[model samples]
Target: MERKYLYLDYLTCIGCETCETVCDFIHDGSPHIRIYVTENKQYLPINCKHCDDAPCVRVCPTHAIYRDEDGAVRIHEDKCIGCLACLQVCPYGVPFYSLKVRAITKCDMCADRREEGLEPACALMCPAEAIQYGPLVMVLELVNERRAKNIPEHRRELGEEELRKSVSSGYVLL
Candidate 1:
């Protein structure tokens, strides 16, 4: 199973909250949102990292969270005890309680849609192209290309290096 990752460009985020709308659309049946967008002076969207060393998988009391063959961290809702252990262990705080199902849920990286070569709902609907999906290596290269060209000389206090590093880390985790 190939690993997949998501990339984000904070500078491009319009803070429109469209990602939140699309998340609800994708999970309309259960109305679950494993991914969501929020603003803190800047548009910020959060989602499950599906960590290479997933804390959720380790902490699930019932073995309810496991990575599929394709490398997606998925929840077996039927086995869930509603313990919320995964919710507690996740460092990124991405998972959310599903009131409709009485279970915990988080992003599966749009695994089903990705298998069909379609983009995740948020990535597709983001009007500013702030969100992206692809192989991690490819996305990193693209990000580097953009960074080299656009960062201005006077904005160094924003710390391009630190910002780039943080964003890259976020991509790998997502």
Candidate 2:
């Protein structure tokens, strides 16, 4: 079983937030994934980094955080005290307090979906095909191919000035 990775093509994202929406719909709360709008108008989609040397797994006092067999850094909610220790240790701050489940949780690569041989909702539903999910090499290859063509670069709209201004308003941290 090859470890899978998710890649977001910044240039291809339309900032529709569909990925985030789908995740929240399934998870029934705030997203485990997020889309950030950069000052340069790039959309940055972020999820768990699933580091080989994961700090969360090492630092969890209750041993709640662990790497799944599929290479996702996952939280064992039953063991979590919601101490937020995982958040502190995470460089990317991927885990979040989920009121819906009353625990800290992060992406498990949509484990149930993956077990059924399905891609994560974010990657599957992205209209722009910005989020690629698969084995690391395949994901990188797809993203690089698109980048080479400069495909789906953000475009200026002649109309909808107000909407554009509102959407492009502020600088967001990646």
Candidate 3:
């Protein structure tokens, strides 16, 4: 199945929480998106990866968690017993027990809005154009293009030794 995912450009994000605000507004004032700013000012917006073999789905005793047609991992509120098995197993820590709903809640990629051909709230609201939604291949292409253009000039100035160290440490210097 061709599935869409959210891709973020850490270089472009300005740490603005417009994405968080819009998500909160969509989810009754409880934000599902989290933005983490690194010491180097890289803005990392964390959300559910919606893994194909989602641990959340596997751990749910009630079978409340399931993947939708678009490959979005979703929770059926009616079946959720709130045992938190899904929360415990999710690697991303995306699932949260909602006291109001008495169930587990997480990002569904705004499935309802997507049904109407709308982008996820975060992508639609990001002012920096840092967030994109599409098939994985397309998104990764964009990510690579942006990273190639935005390699910090300071890294390039650090000479071959630092450049090799950075690359070895999993920093995408290119």
**Candidate whose lDDT is highest:** 3
Q: lDDT per residue, candidate 1, 1-174, as tens digits?
A: 466666667666666877777877787743233334345444466676668899999988899898876566888888988878888888888667777777787787686787797867777888977777767777688778666654453255346676577556543211
Sort the candidates on TM-score, descending order. 3, 2, 1
**lDDT values for all models:** 0.70, 0.77, 0.81
In model 2, how large is the Cα lDDT of residue 52? 77
Question: Whose lDDT is higher: candidate 1's or candidate 3's?
Answer: 3
For candidate 1, the lDDT comes to: 0.70
TM-score of 1: 0.73
Clashing residue pair totals per candidate (backbone < 3 A) = 0, 0, 0
Local error of candidate 3 at residue 5 (angstroms): 1.3
Prediction 3 TM-score vs. true: 0.79
Q: Which ten residues in a row have the lowest lDDT in candidate 1?
A: 29-38
Error of 2 at 81 (Å): 2.1
- Residue-level lDDT of model 3, residues 1-174, one tens digit each, is 578777666666767888888998988888778876779876567788788788888888999999887778899999999898877787777888889899988888899898998879998889988888889888889888776663576365777787777656555434
Per-model TM against the reference: 0.73, 0.74, 0.79
Give the runs in model 1 whose Cα sits over 4 Å from its true position: 29-41, 151-174
Of 2 and 3, the candidate ranking higher by TM-score: 3
Write one digit per residue (lDDT tens) for candidate 2, span 2-32.
7877766665777888989999898776677
